[model samples]
Structure formats: C-alpha cells, structure tokens
Target: MADTGAAIELVGLTKRYPGDRQPSVDGVTLRVDAGETVVFVGPSGCGKSTTLKMINRLIEPSSGSVRINGEDVTGLDPVELRRGIGYAIQSSGLFPHLTVAQNIALVPRMAGWSGRRVRARVTEMLELVGLDPGEFRDRYPRRLSGGQQQRVGVARALAADPPVLLMDEPFGAVDPVTRGHLQDELLRLQRELRKTIVFVTHDVDEAIKLGDRIAVLGERSRIAQFDTPEAILAHPADAFVSGFVGSGAALKRLDLTRLRDLGVPGCPTAHQGEPLPQVRARLRASATDEMLLLDRRGRPVRWLRRADLTHAEGPLTEAGTPVGGTVTRDATLREALEAVLTDSTGRVAVTGPNGVYAGAVRLEGLLGTVRGLLAADRGRAREHQRERESTRPEPTPPEAEGATAGRAEGDAMGSAG
Candidate 1:
C-alpha cells in the first residue's frame, strides 16, 4: 500500500566469512518485481537463507549492491531498512512475555503511530489473520497454540504495512495439517496485500505452491534456474533443476490451474417450488443423468438423478439424489477432480459466488480437460527444445534432446490447473 510494493534487485550480491574457502553467496544476481512472491529454495548451506537475509540487511553483504524500488539499500541505515520490510521466521518468534495485541503493536508503536491508531491496527491485523481479537488479545504468546502463534507472527509482521515481506520457512515448525492450513492462510492474505515477498524454504513443493517465480538455487546460492513455476515444471534448465523438482511434476501442476480456466459446464438447476414440468424439461434437455436442486435463495440443496425423475418426484427439492457438496468456481482443478471422483454419479456440482448453484463438471468433461492440458504441456516442451537447438552455436546437448517426442513441456504452463 506504500507507493506500491517495493521491487527488489540484487546485483553481484556476495557474502563471505573469515577463514571461509568460498563465499556463502557467490555473486548472486536476481530481480523481484513489485508485489511478486519469489521463493528461494535449496538444501541446507546452499546460501538460500543467507541471500534472503541480505535483502532486509539482516545479514550485511561483504560486497555488491541491494536495491529496493530503484534505490540502493546500502547507503540507508540497516535498522531503518529493516523497519520498512516485514520479516517472519520459523516458530512464530513471539516474545513469550508479550500478549498477542502487544506483539502485533510493536512495529506500529516503533513507527510513532498514535496509541489509538496502534490499537486499531492491532485489531484489524488480528481479523485479517483470521483470529478472534477479543478472545486472543489479552492472552500471552504462551497461551496460544502453534497455529495461533504463527498467525500472530504474520499479523505482527504486517502491522506496519510494509511494502516488502521476508519469510524464512514461516510455516516449517507446525504439524503437517497445521502447516497446510497456514500455507492456505498465507496465500489468501497475499491475494489481498500483494506485497513483494521473498520467502526462503528448502521444500520444493512449498516453493512451487507459493512462488510466482521460483529461484532454484545451487551450490554457493548460485541460481540454477529462475522462472515461473509453469516454466520450470515444463522446462527444467538442467538435470539438477529437474532432479530438484523430483517426481510427480505432472500431478503437482494440477494445483496451479483453477476450475474457471476451463469452462466446465454445470448441470441444470431449479428452485424448490418450481413447476415439476418445467424442472423436468430442464433436466431432460441437459442429456445428463442428474440435475441440481437449488433453494429459494439459489443455493444448492440436492442432486436429482435420472431414477428420481422417472419416479415423477412431487417437487424439485424432493426429486433426485441429495447434493453431497459443491465446489466453488475458484477451486483448483485438483479440487474439482477430487469432487468428481467422490461423487456418486461422477458429476461434480460447481457453485458461483455465495454458494449459488452454477453448473456441473461431468467426469467425462473433466477428463477431456486434463487430456488437453497434458497434451498442450508436452507440445510446449517440444517447441522449447526446437528453440534451444536453433539458438545453440554448437551441437545439441543430450539434455536438450530430452524432449518428449512430439510433445513440449510448456503445455502444462498455464492449463495444468
């Protein structure tokens, strides 16, 4: 919100320690656009975390430059530079003696905000992070659960409304389920805040899920590859990057695509008191085995199958099998696919805003989408191979020739979801 999120640039950024044979980060160079989330991922001692800290001056670079929003960071005071960037680390990092409200108010208070404004900010951040302010405010950090403490850490970081956020495996300490929930919360918050985020994680899956562009790091924090997740998935720069992505690349791509990307049709729907004849006609026209029944308010109530209609149901609500659940339009393809698999008729219900019955995504229709996406992804990979070959001055490397026959990797670039 402050003059748009900061755009970060690291040119020849290097850090070395006394008695070290090699620099921890060896002349790393990268650029992060305003309001983008770029994750640095690698194994331990790869310089991923070290490079992340240099952005906010948590660790001073021995040489080179760091810039935020086109201004050099080195000339500025380290404390002031840090104050403008939000930082969250593992295990919440909350002071056990401080109450939740106090923890969140720290930055705002330091920035000389009035007491009234600080309090208002504390309450607002709590709500933004999905915590009940009244119930959690007075409680000390020790009273909160792991997940709750993580939320408070995020709220504290965002309290000052900084233009950049530095996250160091922020969700790493929580249990698997809690970690997943925290990731979802972070993603939702990002959609609203859109801060330039530099997140450091050793987990490839986490990096793929969170980053708009992922910087796959190698020894000494060298950038093995830096590109969009789709590009990386479709075209790994080298064997190291591909090996780092590991197996299940195709399945992982599914989460990146949303249901709306494909115009998946929905089954017919009618209100509870609608005329049976009209509802019957609607169902017959769809040429499907079932239809969705909606409440008077347009929310889904149940599924009306072919057998129920043949029985001449008294009302639309009383007709067809009851709807089990509904998938929102914004849901990912993996979510929609799961719904179809669990659904009795293999016809998943989809909803519009506010749970209104929207359309049905039949299993057959969903499969067609998957086939098309996979095909396109393979095609792109092939094209990338051709381009690389044409641009190379020497003979093609065996790795470049690893294209999948007629298919290219970029096919899954956007539609994999």
Candidate 2:
C-alpha cells in the first residue's frame, strides 16, 4: 500500500489500569501512515486491543500524545472525533431493531445527513460490500446470517466515508470459511478505498495477510518488532518474533513471493534443421557443458552431456540421448528447491504446458537471485537509516580557534586593549 500521508502518531503512549502493577501499553511510540493498514498482533492481554481503542479515544492513554493527520487528538472531544472515524468490532454490532439499510446508515444519520443522502450512502455501501441494496436493505440483522451481518457492519463503517477506520477482531467471531471470504472482501475494499486502517488481531496469519506492515507485540504490551511481512519472515528481529511468526514462516512467504522475482533465465535452443555437429558446436560455444536435444518441431527430446557426446558411436539423433523429469514455470520455489535436491543433475529443465522446454533453472541462479534480493534489501535499510540520521537535528560543533576569523580577531583586539 502506498503511504497517503495520513498518519496516526503515538508519542510514548502508555496505559495503566487501577491496581495493576504493569502498564497495559508501555512506552509505545509508533506511526501508522495514511491509506495504509497496520495490524497490531500479539498474544492475549498484549495490549493490542488497548492500543487500538486508544487510537479513537475508546481507551485513554495514561500519558503522552496521540496525533492524527499531524493534529494532537489526545484532548479532542471523543464523541465528535469518533463520529468522524469508522469503528467496527467483533460480532458485527448491528442494532436488531434496525433494518440492514438503517443499520448501515447509522453513522451518516449521526453525522447530520439528510434522508435522501443517507439512503444513497446506504445503497452505495451495500453495493461496495458485495451485498445487493435492494435484496438486503430492508432485512434486519436478526434475519441475516452472521457473515451477512458482519458484511453489513463493514458497510456501515464505510457509510460516512471516514478517512480512518478502527477495527478490533472484526471477523474473529465468524467461521473459517466466512472469515476467509471477509478477508478477501476487505482486501478488495481496501484497495479501492485506501482508508487509513488500524486493525487489531490475535491471529498472526491474518495480520500478515491484511497488514501492509505488522506490529508484533510482546508480553506487558511491548512491541517486539514492526516491519513488512517479507522482511519479518526473512529476518526476524529476535527469538520472540520468530516464534510468534511460527514454524511455517517459509510457506507463509510464498504468499508474498512472486515467480517473476525468482531465477529462471533463457537458455540456448537447438533448431530442427541444424545438423548434429552444428548443434553440438552451438552447445560448446554456449559453454553450458550440456546441450538440450530438441526434436524437428523444436521440442526437447533429451539432454546430451559433453562426456556422452565425446564417446558417441555416430552423429547425434533423438535416440542418441534422452532427457528426464521436468518442472513447469508456475511451480513454487519450495518445489524447485526439492527438485534440485532430489535430482542427480544440478539444474532442472523448466517446460511449458505442452512439454516444450521454456528455459533452464539452476540452483546457482536461485542462490544468486536470493543473494541479490538480500543485498538490495540491505542497501535499502542502510539508506533508510541514513535518512533517519540526517533528519535528526545534529548538535552544533564546539567553537574553535581558526574556525571563525571574527572570533580570533575579537580575541586579539581584546588582548591588545
């Protein structure tokens, strides 16, 4: 998600309940950019919920300031501020007495919208959430399924077109299938609306899936790490973050991974009309050590190693040597890794749908791609650090003789006088 310049800044935010020895949120300082979704994730009582609530003044911070869009909101009128922000919680908190349209239109009405405006907004939001306005407008929450009610709750959250959205376990109470559907719907909605969203969840997978960046919290409400999903998975900050990410971090990475970013490069091909010797010569010139044998139609027939060709009884033909197992282009890196590990050959032949050779994929190339990606990542991190250092105010250098001609002349004149 691109940062839209909308931000929620917490400056040393802390919260302590009466009689509690430890703060629910302790010395937390974070910035959630505009039009970006930042998920707060951790175990039970990690202060994720408390932190989320504090964003909209649902829970007051024990100390420090909360700023939204660069304005200090710590002392803002809670009712007025919340009315301008979207809020959704577990169980799709809809009023049973109100119809779906009425429920979704609550915020607009509260904001002093006229009847026609409210009706138009209700229709628009229901359509936005994949619900037909005509089909569900008059239906009450009690008449709708749990999933439908939650969808309506989400629609209601967007009714007023609020710039910021606070969601606390919005889909947690739903079944797995419903949750998955809602997740996809939410992603689609976010892509279109680009709301500045602060989402709190205990599910790490959900956080990884939904968040542009995740803030992983620890016990006593401490933030262990906050970073992109790929960075967090590839290089966790510490043991706590790693364990929190779980054992299948590699598999989770697949979701963020792309085949175009991996290592599969074009290789030399043998033409059908070219003589066997010509093909062999081309292979030697290419310096691949092995040549792929292609048929008259330019489809791979077999692999001919240099050693096999040197000891050949006659000119090479399709029957001379044959290739073995092949993999497809869309295969996962995990699959490619397995193929490289199990095969006797160091390289795997990548083919197309009809078994035509696409290109060659080698372990070395894969390693190279990984190394390049990592180096680029390191460079970016160093650049970011440098930028941060530059942005910080530097201390003035101590005054010294010869550094200022004026100071030296004044000192000399004073001494003479």
Candidate 3:
C-alpha cells in the first residue's frame, strides 16, 4: 500500500531453551538493508526458522539484540513491537472462522483505523494480490485453494502497511506448480512494495530466485556464507557452502540473470482478424517460418505458419496452434530456456506486464549470450588482477647487500686460484 521498508540488524542473536546444553540459534549477526530481500537457507535443524522468529520475538532470543532502522527493539514490549511488523507462515496460518475481509482487517482495525479505512484497505490488498475483492471478501479459508489461502495470508500480513516482513516458508505447503506461481507473485509484490524481507527456506533454488543476498547457515545457525547469489554460486565460501549449493550451479546462475538483459529479438506479429493473405505475406517476408497472432489488446493468442493458413479460414482466430507458452521480461533465462525446449518451434514468445507481446528468444542466442557474459566477467577479473599487481610496490631486504658481497668475493678467489 505504501513504500514502507526498514533495515534490520541482528547482533549476536542467540536462543537457548531451558535444560538444553547448547543453543539452537547461536551468535547470528546480520544486516539487511531497506528494500532488500534476504533469504536464510540451510539444512533441516539448522536453526534458520529459530533465527527468523527472534527478529519478531515470536520465540524470544535468550541473548543478543534486534535492531530495526538503527533502533534496538529487543527491549521494547513484545506485543507492541510485533504489531508494527508483518509475519506470514506456512499453512497460511489464516483463521478458519474468519472471512477473507475480516482476516485482512485484523491489523488495521486493531491499530485503531476507522471502519471505512479498514474496508478500503481490505479491498486494496485483495486486488494487489490479484484476487477479485467482491468475490473473495466473503470467502473463508476452508473454501479457498492452497494458493488462494496463501495470497489471503499475505494480504492480511500487509494490511497494516508494515515496514518489514518476516516470511517463514510461506509457500512451502503448496504444490510445486502453485509454489512457483506464488514465488512469482511475491517477486511482483516486492517490485512494487519494496519491503525489507527476511525469508527462511530450505530450498536453495528458491533462495537464488528470490533473494538479493543468501545466508547459508550451518548447525546452530552458523553462517557458512553470506553474500550475493551470483557470488555464492560462482565461488562458495567453503566445503559446507559448496555442498549446500548442490549441483548445476551454472544453471542456477541462469535464474539470477533476466531475459531482458540479453536483449530478445522481435518476431513477426499480426492481429486476430487480419486478412490471411496479408498474414502469409508477413510470414514469408520474415526470416522465420512462424508468426504470432495477437488479440485486440495485443496479447499473444496463437502461432501461425503458411501451411496452417492454406485452408483459407474465415477469421485468423482459429487458424493455427494456440500460443502454447510465453514468458515475461522479468522471467529468468532458465525459465525462458525451459519454455524454448518445450516449444516445437525452438523459440518462446516474451510478453510485458500487460501480456502484450514484447519479443522472441531462441536457444542458441540465449546460450551464446550467457557464454559471452561469463567470458566478459572473467576478462574483467583478469584485468583487475593485472592492475593490482602493477601497482604493488617491490620489497627490498637488508641481507641482500651482504649476500651479494659474499658472492663477489667467492668469484674473485676462484679467478685468482
């Protein structure tokens, strides 16, 4: 609703339960900048979840401090402190008895907002998460799908317009396909909302896809590596971090890189009702054998070839195969690669936010661009190394003069003899 985000800092945060010999989360110190999404990813029992809870004091840390925008909040009243931050968890944590609107209105209403403001905020949040407010406002948690429940949970979390959000595996309970969609939705929301997010997950791929920086934790919340996704993928800090990164690091790098950065080429396109003769001429004029058909709004609808149009159909609407797959510019190269491999044409259409056709991408071009980028990065690295070496001063040793004099004396004695 508002551009609200604050930096979060954890200073030696530790959590120990009574009668336990060791702490579950020990000495976890990190800083998250405002509007940055930092993901804590590690193996099970690594205390990632425990570390996240300490930030919001869900499970208070036995020691250490929590700071929000340079203000230490650990000593504050936990109830009042929590009211200012948003929290979402797996299984949605939505109340079964409450309707969607009521669930979203909880925070704002409790914060002393007027009824009119609360109602308006509920509608705005629902729409922000892509749900029709009119239809879903009255629905309960049990009546919604797994994905829908998660959306509602997020809406409720953001209802109060909190400056920071703590999400502990919020999409873990959904199916893989739905989980992917939810991840995309979160990315879209972050683009608009820019909330300082600390996400906890066990999925490294998910971390790479969503995080501005990733903290790979070890036992007792030990941070093995804390760096950008690209840095972690290219050069892991140690053996544990390398193993956690798993196989296919190169492919994972594709996820960090976007398609728009590669500069996708445009393809021939025609409107839905365009004349067949004109479509055929356009397709022939183009280098490729296929052309994309767009509806009135310029969204991709179908793919066409000259052979499919030989029958002379009435409106070009049903002339050819449906546009089986498409990707947005924000989509990763890995996603585009998957779409390309699945398509029969060895290419995939790219669309903008409004689903309007933007461009097309091919397998060869995508791979070549990645290779060029990698080579360029290497070249820059080598150049940097050479510059550093050239600027470094040479060292002179005190013993060098004596050693040289002794060597000269030995040579003179040998010549005289």
Candidate 4:
C-alpha cells in the first residue's frame, strides 16, 4: 500500500445540527501539510472533535470543502472515504469475539487482500505497534490491558496502511502513567510512520508536546488562535488565549525540547597524566571552585576543588568531594533544571547510555536557552500580526500614510533592537 502522508485542507467548514440556533463549527479555514501532525485543542463542546470527524466523513459537514492532496473529497462516499483513512477513538473499540489477529486483519480483509497477505500484514502491524504477534495474535480483547488494547486499536487502524490517521482522545481511558506510556508509544510510531494525523485533545500540554502546530478553538468551533506551540505560549493572541494557556506557560514550552538538543557544555576535565598547572588553569578558567577528575578510561573520579588542585601535580586522583546526581541526554529541561538545582556542584553532569560522562549543563545555560526561545517566539508572533494587518483590504486615508509608515518603521526598529 502507498501510505505516504496526504495534505488535508478545510475551507469555510461549518456544521449545523437540526433545530440548533448556531452551527457547531463555524466557517473555519485551515490547511494541514503532508506528514504534519496537527492537534486541535479546546474545552468540551468545542468543535475540535467535529472538525476531526469531518476529515474522514465520520460526521458529514453542513456545508464546506474537505480536500485531501488537492482533490475534493467532500463528495466522496462516506464509507469509501472512511475506509481509506485510519480512525482511532477513545476506547480500544475492539470486537470482543474477535481475536487480535482477526481484529487487525479486518480492514485488509475488507479491502480484499488474500488470506496470506492479511496474515502477514497483521503480523507486521502488531510488531510495528510493539506487540508480539506470536503471543498476541490469538488473544481476545478482554485478555489485554487498557494500554495494550489501545495499541491494538492503533494497529488495526493501520492494517490497511492508510495515509491519514484521525485520533480522538485515544489515550483518555487509561490511568495517568499508562496514558503517558501510550502517548510515548504514539510519538515513537509517528517518528517511524509519519502519517498525516489530526489529533483531538483538550489538554494544552499534550497538544504542545505532540503537535507540529496546534489549532486552539473557541465558541461555535471558531479558531481562537492557530500557530506553533512556542509562538502561542510566548505571545498569546489575546486575553482569552492567555487564560486558556493557564499558568506556567513558559515551563510548558520549556518541556518541548530535551537538554541534549540544546547542546549543553561539558565540564572541564583532567586525565591521569595532566600537568598540575593545566588542572589549575582549567579550574580557574571555569570560574568554578571544583573540576572533574577522570580515571585512565575517561570516567568521572570525583570533584577536585581548586583547594585540592595541587595534589602532587600528577594525574588527578580519588581525593575529592563526591559527585552529585547525573542526568541523561534524553531528559526534559524540567528534569535538567531539577538536576542543576539539586547538584552539590554548579554543573549538571550528563551521561550517555553507557553510563559514561557525556557533558555538563549549567543553570545559567538553561536560562539563556529559555530566554532565546521566548524572544524568537515573540518576534515571530509580532511579525505575523504585522503581516496580517498589512494584508487588510481597507484602504488607509492619504494623510494617515505618514503615521502608518512611522509605525511600520518603529516596528522594524523595535524588532531589530
């Protein structure tokens, strides 16, 4: 199956139910590029779920356009449209009577794949979702845990290799720890599969962590704001957006990237044969009271303070303070911050998978990265606002041109400054 991600576009999309005073989803226009995972987030009763269902024609729109890869799919038969797109809902949605293999093979079977091909596809998808086909192929749905069942639902959705996937709070039924595990699994699969995904969730942090971009909705399903998580967190579109972001928005954005991605600096280190003056230079140059002492194989010995930098002027040894806690490269900035705060020394030591020292990060470095991200986000928001204002159809009075120019110039200077 050709499963390349397809771009989805919705234009003037509106949905109104019978006897309703207003449409559930107003005229909302948005485009999702190929391979992009867009999260729709808002309060309950918002049109986010309605919007997601419309993509696969689960819920027919009152009037609007739904296009996939530039082809108008709004007119396509609902059943055919849905069969080609993957959909995963809140619960696992597995058939109680069907074994795991049969459940996963349902879609391919519908598509007229041969028995042998269906079996192979089922095995591939089960393994793709991290379930062992040998063990789980014949197990009934009731025999699996909530998380495992959700994985089966996901695998079943992909059995036919659909190009697009729609998920609606698919992890909502599990416990918090299980939900986190499922979320991580989805992230892992997304990296390998790159399916065009429309994910619906009410949690801002989840949206921020999972989405390449997010669409925040308001009353009647209108888009309150649509942008990347960083820009939205740094410069909310209005008071409504700010309030919805809740508290600690900065920390939420900080969680988006791990510590190693920031390229944190390593601590000054001396091997077993380094000169005394060299060790002293490194310690003083670092402006820290202690430095890392290494054994012959380049692992941390102990904290060698400037007071103990002499020590016979030979290779550094075991006479130093105990090292503080270590952090891994994959740890979030929140964890990195914790490590930095709790460390006895000023640095947060980083370790690789082999338990060998990789690098070190200082609190100041983390702060600097946060500041840089915030500044860039604000700048992007301001630039986008200006471009929107510039594109307005209203013509300015001739006399107002001077003021507009001045404002534009001032904005440019402000951006530069």
Candidate 5:
C-alpha cells in the first residue's frame, strides 16, 4: 500500500433526481487539501450524503467535475476511480458471512495484490485500527461488537492505502462512549497517515471535533459557511450557520486545540521496581507531596503520596491510590478538562502511544489556556471587523458629495503648499 494523500476538488458539483423540481445537491464547490479532513455537516435531508457519494460516482454527479490530486476522475472508469478512493459507511457495512480478514482483503485483491501481500495488509490494517490480527482476523462480523465491527470497516477502507477516504457517519451507530473512542482512534490515525478525508455527518460537534475545515450545508446542498472550526465558531457566516453552531460555541473551541499543542509539564515520578529506601528519599526531596508511579515500560501505574511511602515496606507497585484519570496527548483540551475535573487530583496524566507516560495537565493551566484562547478569538474578531470596515464601499450623500469633493481638493492644495 502506497503512503499517499491526495487533494480533492469539486467544481460546480450537482446531483438531480429524475423529474425532481430541485437538485439534491446544487453547485457545491469544495476543496479538501491533501492530508486534511473536511467535514460536511447539515440537517437531515440536506443531501450531504448524496454529495459525498458523487465524489466516487456512486451517486454520479449530474454536472461538474471531481478531481483527485489534480487529475479529473469524472471521466475515469467508476470502478478504477473507486478502487483508489476508500469509502466507509454507517453500520460498519461488513458482509456478515465473511471473516474480518476476508472483508479487509477485498480492495487489495481487486487491485491484483498477491495473496501474501493481501494477507500482510489485512494484518497491518487491523493493527492500525487497534485490533489484534491474531484475535480478530478469522472472526465473522456477527461475532464482533458494534465498535469492533466499525474498526474492521475502517481497516477495510484503508487496506489498500487509498489517498482519499470518504466516511459517512461511520461512528453514528455506536454508543456514545464507543463513538468517542472511535473518534479518538481516527484522530490518532490521521496524525500518522495524513490522508485526505471527506466526512459526512449531521452532528455539528462531531464536525468540529474531526474536521480541519467544516462545510455547513443548507437546502439543495448549498454551503452556508466553509471555514476552520475556530473561525466558524468565533464568527458564523449567517443566521443559518449560527443556528447550526447552536450554543457552547466557546466550549466547542476547545476541540480545535489538542493537548500536544500545550506544553504539558512533567511531575515527580518513580518506577515500580525501585528500592523502597531510594523511593522514600526521592519523595522527600520532591517539591510536591505526590509522585506518579510508572511501570517498567514507563506507563503510568499509580499515584504515590508521601504518607504512603512510610507504610511501604514492600514493592512500590502495591502502594497508593490507583491512577484513574488518564488521557492521550492526541486528546483535545475539552477532554483533558473533563478528565481533570472528574478525578480527585487537580491534574490528569497524559500518555503517548502504548500508554507510555508523556506528561500531565493541571486544572489551572487549562483554565489559563481557555482564557487565552477566548481573548485571542476576540482580538481576531475585532481585526476582521476593522478589515471589513476599511474595505467597505461607503455611499456618498447627494448633498454632501460636492462638499466632500471640495474638502478633498482643499486638503490636497494644503498638502502641496
């Protein structure tokens, strides 16, 4: 599978049903940059799905062109074009009779990959989506949970390493908790793969969470506003866009920033198998009363307090309260805030790949970050207002026009003198 991310452009894309008075999608022109995730969000029946399918010619655009990476794909054979574009839909869309490995191998096989290569890709993709190839490869779809099935669906989509991925409410069928996990997984994958993604969903928050840019659609697939989540949240284009943004625009801004962007400071720490005397000495020297315990692999295990050290005659692993609240660096600020608020500790542990300890985020830091973000947004809004005012064409009053011209001429003469 090639590691490629392609730019997608739609020019005047329209879709009409036979004998219908209005087209389902009318003149939707959008550009999704390579390695960007662009989400299409709108009310139900707004033709977001129809517009998504037209990219692969599944719905077949009635007019306009679909270009991938610079080449026009509208004239290309639908089958070959689809082979290059990964599409995943709602409900996992897995063939129930087929095993997970078989389902994932479909695309690679269609491209004439050898059996060994297809098998290797199947294993690689499953692992890429956090599924164990040994455990899940041979299991039928019926044997898997909704979340597991969705992971397999994603694995299948990426098996051939398509440059572009089209996902239509792929996580909508799962429970809220599972949906969140899937969203987090997608973010992690995007960070690594950087594929161009066009995602369709009616959930505004989801769009804000996943998209690099969001296209808010209205009737007949009219794009009301297309911009970054921060821009749209700070300044909606119109009433329709504002209504779609709903309340909590400020909180939604938190999703635009990730924990990695903030410099998460490290706290005092101790390893599990360290000597009890050494651990006691370190804890006494530490500024804080608490220390984070890590396993041999450097993953967070427990939080040790100064008092717990006195009673610990044995291994440090069997000491202090178990570390409960944890978040990955890929987690958004909102998620980190939620974890910190729920935990008894004022801070939450941040981890990297394979649960390795990265750093920690404190409540005070998050509060300060949020305040800074709001202040910056306000500043940008003011600047945009100034720009608009400067560029605006002001109409001259009929009576004042002659006076204004005379005043301008006098000012010019005074400057010359």
Candidate 6:
C-alpha cells in the first residue's frame, strides 16, 4: 500500500468537443506518484478540470490514454472506476436527505459492502475528518455549518479507503478561516494516509501550501511548468507563470521556506532586572547598537537602544517601550517578512507558543534565505537546460554526392509523368 507508484499517468491526452476549433486539453502528459499530492493550477477555462475529470473518465478524452496504477483506465467502466476512487468537490455535495453517516457511507454501500462494514468505515472516516462520529453521524447536512459540511465531503470521499483521491477545489466553498483550517487538516491526513492525491485549485497560495509538486497549466491545458512548490515559486517558467504566481512571490516564498536554512547568529540579550551598565556591556560585547530585553522569566519584552542607557534610567526594566513585532519559530518566512516590514526595527522576536524566547530573526538572516533559495533555483534551471540540450537529436552529416542521386532522378521522372 505504501509503494503503489505512479498512481495516475496521462500520455498525450487531448480532449475536443464537437464544433470546437481548438482542443480543450492538448496533449497533456503528466504523472502523479503514489503518496504524492500534485496540484493543477491556472486561470479560468484553462482545462485543468477537464484534465482531472478525464482521469476517472468523467469526461472522455478524444485521444490518448489515462492510466491508474499502471493500468489503462480509459476503457474501464466509468462508474465502477469512480466508485473505487475518492472524489470531492467545492460544495461538499452532501445529500441533505441522508444523515452524515449515510452520506459518508454512500460509496461503500454502492460498492455492496455489508451494512456493518459500511457503518464501521463511516465512523472511521468521520473521526478522520475531525468530526466526532457519535455526535455528527446522526446529524443531517443541514444541521452542520459550511466547514462542517466540507469535512463531511472529505469523509465521504475517503469512506471506501480509495488509493487515489481527486479533489476539485474541495475547500473553495468555505470562508477563508475555515479554508485554512481544512487545508491544515488535509496536510495532516496526507502525512498519515499517503494517498496519491490530485488536487485542482486556482489559488496559487493554496497550491504552494499543499502541493508536493505543482503542474502550472496554461491555455489549452498545456503544462507550462511542473516542479516542486519551492522550485515553481522561486523560478516560474514564463511571464504567464510569473504573473499567475503573482506580485508577492518573494514574500510568499517565505511561507514555503523555512528559517533553519538562514544562518542566524545569536543576538545579545538581557533580563529586565539587569543593571543598565551590565546591559550596555553585553550590547558592546556583541558589537551591536541595541539589546533585546527579556522579562523576569526570560521571555522577550522590548528592545533597548544603546542611547537609552545614557539617560537616568536606573535599570533597563522598562515595561513596554517599542518591543517590535514577534513571530513564532515555525511561522513562515513570508510572515517574518511582513513582521519586519511592519516594525520599525526591521527585526522580529521569535517566541514559542508558551511565550518563551526562542530566537530572533533579522533582515540579514531573511535576505540570506532568499538568496540561497534563488541560487538553488538557478542551479536547477541550468541543469535542466543542459539535460535538454544533451537529449536533443543531433543533425546528420552531409552525404556524398552519389548517395541520393538515384532517388532524386526517380522523383524528377515521376513529376514529369
């Protein structure tokens, strides 16, 4: 179950409808490895949905093939194939008439599982999606909130333990807060389940957050670029990919990027009750202009400038004098950037959830991470270019004059006749 491998593959896939001058999807070829999540992203009407639907035969392809688990699924019965794969949509699509358990059990029941097995599976799925089975199983969709219904949608999709999951904007219908929660939940689930997931979304942020790899779709369903989220964000293929990724890509990079990559040295720190001279001495020892003041419990309180020590303040025990912004250690690079921008000091205090001083992040460290990311991206690009050049067919050398003479004479005689 762990190593199913290449759960879905599309080779030269194209789909065209009647009277259409252009194909909806033109020769799309991509593969999704088992236990990996790939997100297809593009502007409206870019044929991403059509490409996904073709995988389960929801929309038949005009040509080419769709294979699941190394088997060509294009010829398989569409209904049976879909039943074995998990499918979730924007609106949850739960049946209001049925209880939550019944809605979740729909697929298992359709597959002719015994009622006891179906019930057990339904209960498991409900728990998996963060809904208590005892409470939500008997409740109808109408009794749940938008977020709740979407959770139910995910539960129903996983009811039969499908190895492949197809999600088409599954959280699109929920509010921003709920959408974020659902995204985190899905990430947690994916970490545990390791299902091969194909998630389609137009949100670049979401794509960067959830996708192990991203397929950037362009007009006519052409794949502009396919790579890991970090690579895609760092090095977009063209103007379309760049614009689609949006203006704040550098800042967004922080969200996907981590702080550990940035080599940040420790800054001088002092407790609140420390003498002013001692604080000044620590600041001078660190060769820095300011010192971070920590509370009695060694939690960050505020920053103290060297000049402030010159005043009559007996100690640097100031309660709250321009502490600046603080961020958690796990906060994305993007959030750190925002904190730096909003604060005047261009520095952010890193603290744990329990309010313990973890470390500090300065503009220098942040810049270093960005540079490292960009450098790695450029290296990859050069390698890809080299690969393409080496793989390209070389031209044949010119032949001797007599080599094609007979063929040329025959062609001339045929044309004359």
Tens digits of per-residue lDDT for model 2 on 1-417? 122325789888899899999888898899998888999999988889998888889898889788988888876889888877789999999999999998988878988999999999998898888788889999988888889999999999878888888999999999976775577678768878899999989998788777899999997568899999878886789999999889976566544533434646877667555666776677788857777777665667777777766666554663335656555554445445556666677777776434557787778766665566557666877887888799998765656434677788899999999
10: Cα error in model 2, Å: 0.9
Compared with the true structure, what per-residue lDDT tens digits does model 4 show for residues 1-417?
A: 248889999999989999999999999899998889999999999888998988888788899989998878877877778889999988889999999999999988888999999999999998887788999999999999999999999999988989899999998898865665566567768878899999999998778877889898998779989999877887788988889989888678666887657886777787777777867888888866766776676666577777787664544565576566766665567667777877755466776533457787888888788788878767777898899899989988987999999999999999999
Misplaced by over 4 Å in model 1 are 1-3, 260-331, 335-366, 386-417
**Maximum-lDDT candidate:** 5
Q: Which runs in model 6 stand beyond 4 Å of their true positions?
A: 1-6, 258-417
Please estimate how well model 4 matches the true structure, expressed as its whole-model Cα lDDT: 0.82
List lDDT for all candidates, in order.
0.85, 0.78, 0.88, 0.82, 0.90, 0.82
Candidate 4 deviant stretches above 4 angstroms: 259-332, 335-417
lDDT of 6 by residue, 91-112 (tens): 9999889999989989899989
Find the candidate with the highest TM-score and give its number: 5
What RMSD, rounded to one decimal, does every model reach?
11.1, 13.1, 6.0, 10.9, 5.3, 7.9
The TM-score of predicted model 2 comes to 0.63
TM-score of each: 0.74, 0.63, 0.85, 0.69, 0.89, 0.67
Task: Give lDDT: candidate 4, residue 413.
Answer: 100
Candidate 4 all-Cα RMSD: 10.9
lDDT for model 1: 0.85
Better of 4 and 5 by lDDT: 5
Off by over 4 Å in 3: 1-3, 273-287, 296-298, 354-356, 377-417
Judge candidate 3 against the unseen true structure and give its global Cα lDDT, from 0 to 1.
Answer: 0.88
Q: Considering summed lDDT, which 10 consecutive residues are worst modelled in model 6?
A: 257-266
**lDDT tens per residue, model 5, 1-417:** 235789889999999889999999999998999999999999999999999999999989999888887788877999998898899988999998899999999999999999999999998998899888999999999999999999999999988999999999999999976787788889999999999999999999899989999999999899999999988998899999999999889888888888888877898888978888898898899787888999998999899999999988878878898889688887888888888999877888999776789988889989999999989878888999999999999998988999999999999999999
Which structure is stronger by lDDT: 2 or 6? 6
lDDT of 3 by residue, 1-417 (tens): 134899999999999999989999999999999999999999999999999999988998899999998888877888878888899999899999999999999989888999999999999999888798999999999999999999999999888999899999999999976786678778878999999999999999899999999999999999999999988987788999999999888678788878767677898999977777888888888888778899998998988887887775688886888988788777787888888998877888898655779988988888787798678667766886788799998776769878989999999999999
